[model samples]
Target: MSIPTGTVTFLFTDIEGSTRMWERRREAMQEALKRHDTILRLTIESHRGYVFKTVGDAFCAAFTTATDALESAVEIQRKIDKTDWGEAPIRIRMGMHTGTAEERDGDYFGRAVNRVARLQSAGHGGQVLVSSSTQELLADNLPEHIVLKDLGSRRLKDLDRPEHIYQAQIGGKEEQFPQLKTLDIRPNNLPVQVTSFIGREKEIDEIHRLLNAARLLTINCPGGIGKTRISLHATTELLDIFHDGVWFIDLVPVSGKDGMWQAVAGALSIRSETGIPLDNTVIDRLKNKELLLILDNCEQLVLEAAETAGALLAGCPDIKILATSREALSIPGETVYQIQPLSVPSAAEETQGEKSCAAGISEYESVRLFIDRALQIRQTFVVTNENAPALAQICRWLDGIPLAIELAASRVKMFSLKELYERLGDRFEALNRGLRTAPPRQQTLRALIDWSYDLLDEEERELFMKLSVFTGGWALKAAEVICGSTAPLPVTAPPAWRDFIDPDHNYTYKTEGSIATYNDIKPDLDVIGLLERLVDKSLVIANQTDGSTRFVMLETVRQYGEQKLNDSGKSRETLKRHLHYFLLFVENYMTQVEDVTQNIWDTPIREEYPNIQTALKISLTEKEYYEYGVRIISSLFTYWQYHGSEMEARVWLEQFYPFPDYIQDPLTRTWITLMFGWILSSTLD
Candidate 1:
């Protein structure tokens, strides 16, 4: 590349309020440009200038002398001012700088070009600004003719030192004409501590890769899993790579569809002179610039945000967007990274001491974070030979989830690690005492989860509670059975209640303990609809894979749901119906070879076996067993035999063995006889 070694002045000019001029009164701006185009060309030519190109409504041009460039800029503004339409007048911003610029084939090139462009962008619309070099050159020649205000030195792109700038005044007053093109405004002072992202190196690396290549990258994870923190950290890491500074838009604060664009405009600090539409203007401004944008908390308004992001990506090739949410935006060229939870310590390793706990935790991110935070709270918190095992066991009990671990760790000031470990099962009772300072939503582990719970509808809340009957995980069909049992019937108290017990006694005694059977049940809800609503509300934790959706419940969530279910004002009959529904579902599964085999020992379901077993043990009354339990156990025989858990099957059958009605019925009797005989033979042999 040959370098040019002569005095050259680069001129960068922007059309102010171009979007408003084009969109609001497009015909008028087009007509004005047409009428003024000839005059504009002649003025530049007379000053020995050549128009390089136009950016939206802005234009770049070249001149050999700063004086000539300044004169051309003055005439263009003068001609536009002279040719005015009825409602809106034409306006523009012109910036000039004198520096030796290299000629690349036919186009102008060099750092001077970049400086002039940045300087032009700094000036408000309807103003002409020039660097000190150009101002001095003009002052030396025809200083008395044109008015100039010495604006102090300011920062521009790629320049360390502030450059001296002067704005030209027309007729001793600043022009009040509107800008024709939309201009870019940089948002100021982002949130502090974005780099405090505790873990997730692999996720951050994947996000960085996606942003570097894809037009859109979405970070998706469960609530309290730190998607927001990770995205912000990634943004902070990527700040240096983008020319235009990173823009952070917090979506959680925005309430409506229109508020999204307003938030974005506010973040960019856009102040339009004529109440311009910020959306179209923002798109146009970002089109030609290289920028990194972080849009946080997009799940609630995913469709709206996705539409906007898609438009931005299509319009702005140089722009990359990073969005964080509980789900994906699903836009084109979008890459999604699902963040996983932190590592939790294993039960055995933590039993020895802090050393073993720390060693186990070092293998997983979540457990490591828990240890680090817990240690901060208690200085004596060491992964010693003694505490290590207990810490590991505690982390395991908490599932190594960051939020749960954090809450668990916060109790160190008031509770010992051993106390926390022992009370892990009663999280609400244990963690509720500390952190009155935390937000109401995050005050306790239960409160944090309840926020998501409280957002559910009546049906969703009830279904979520009923789902807690399931231990760790369960099949969707099983949930449907459990929730659907008495949906078709209205709830009614047992006849014994109305006949023998008074209302006050029933309330008091019911709180003490209550029990009823399915024959007296009433169903008030549509089970299918309830399940759908619960799944929709996210009150039910669903695991969908390989074309099937499974659901499971956290113990804490289950307890919350059960409380809601009882409070839903249902009679004892509805509760019985709910229990019966689960029994009938298990029975249905026993009849189907495919159903029993498919989920008999698989994950999430396998985890819930204890709960299922307990439910079966308690709810499989003589009447329900004769009605439904016989069929389910028969279907499960194959599974039990394969897994060598014939003892569990036989033990469950012991409840039904005395219910001779089921054993006598051929349909139920045959499967029961076979399973019982098999278990007997296997044990005896």
Candidate 2:
């Protein structure tokens, strides 16, 4: 047969379980192989295809048109499925792909040839798989009874991008076999860890229990808290429990819902045929396999991941998903395991025994981890009485975050434990010694936070930075008042509030007086949704307090946000808004004091004291805003008297005394004078 050149469609065929047939019925297998070769060749010739090569029971043929190639494949499957050898049935799997190829010495070679072979390998016996290119060429031209089912995009061996695959459905009595051997041959694809896995014994057991009870388990935690490590360790322990084997799919490189399933198919070595939806291919492949799929780094693509997990759980009964993300998938049957930081010894525990300092230090999981990682770089490093306190201090400073601890431990070759602890105050700089092989985001604490920050939309990013104004944390109502203002202060607002606004630009604020209402804002950038997105991205954490949710950031993340706010050169304006909002918040509470109990007003004020103090500090420094500062401090005088320091209030009043010229508000001026007089009397008496 003559080899075809240029854009030619290649069809490759091989028998399923051919080796087993040869061993069980060697004589009958030879006869069956002969019949398979005869039927394939005849079908190719009839469809204007040329058989280029034949190896054992396999045939490689080429045709000028995809229609001819697909037609030949369908006919071969039909003929083989109907024919019977006394002992062996000739079930042939065929694959067709269209691409440009070079013909030399009666042979075909190039990516097209290799692709067709991979496609053939990805099919079951009596099934015909076609590449998307071939399916497109044969679009609306398939013979009656020949239909194409899209299998979605797939990452074939050695290919950079995924290729769409399709299955040629020929209605008949053809035998339906198990999933393609190409996908099932190598079920597990977990990466080998370079370092030893540590701790999480209880976590591993609990994960096992959760997996047994729930079809989907997501390990949720902030970056650098060790979610990935814990999931990997837990999966490794449960390897034997899964009969089909455990597979790991890294979704960091995947961007959307389509790419997510492609990653899963690639990990399972399932090369989807063109024309069939990839999700369908995944569900079909996993429906019967009792296996565990570990999806890592799903936070950025959480919505897509959640949808895919939900679909898989609903479609595949025996497939369980163990996903590692910054937050829960929120799908039905999903059990979220929030991974916490490793435990660090308390100061008392660190100082308990001088002679047994090393033993005591090793007892805490965080310190033990630090020492182990430190030994990797500095072999002679060991815990002793001289450095136990510093070691404990280092772990505590890093908040027992595993990634931070590992990065810090990497610096032991240069800095002493004490020096490391001292430098941790500027953790973004101290944690820069990450291993070169680590991912870019894990290279520095700032980079880790930057990654999560970059994923936010404009409004979300703005809200995140503005949220840094709160030191401890703030309630949803406070966030709405402070950071939810997308529009500027309206012209109709009080002149005192409008004075802080940029008069050069138009300003519009949400309707006044009702703190619970969020309807008077931009529909696209709702404050509630932005806050929830921040929480979902693990940038902000939500805590339950007195039946309400309070959102806060980790100290490290807040510092990063503050740095971003400073870099944006908007810290001054944001602080102004923060101070203005808090002043109004206090005023509103004061007016309601007659109807509400002290606890009602004091509880929230006490919770926001740190934020109020931060705003006051910034306000006090701005000479032009000194009057506003005095007004805010005076408005909260009762709060200061009941819940804060009377002496501190007096000091603030004295700071503003020298700037009386800036005091435009008469009531604020009089209140400041009265507070100053009372502080003087109390100090003297």
| TM-scores, each model vs. reference | 0.55, 0.61
Per-residue accuracy of model 1 over 537-572 as CA lDDT, tens digit each: 334556787887767654555665666666766524
Regions of candidate 2 where Cα sits further than 4 Å from its true position: 1-187, 196-202, 256-258, 272-282, 344-364, 380-397, 486-524, 587-602, 635-661, 665-685
Best by lDDT: 2
lDDT of 2 by residue, 531-625 (tens): 88788778888899678888888777888899988898888877876776666655555544542224424466777778777777877878766
TM-score of 2: 0.61
Per-residue error for 383 in candidate 2, Å, reads 4.9
What's the distance in Å from true for residue 603, model 2? 2.6
RMSD in Å for model 2: 23.3
Show model 1 residue runs off by greater than 4 Å: 1-190, 194-196, 330-333, 345-358, 433-440, 454-466, 484-547, 553-559, 569-582, 585-611, 617-685
lDDT of each: 0.63, 0.75
* The 10-residue segment with the lowest total lDDT in model 1: 506-515
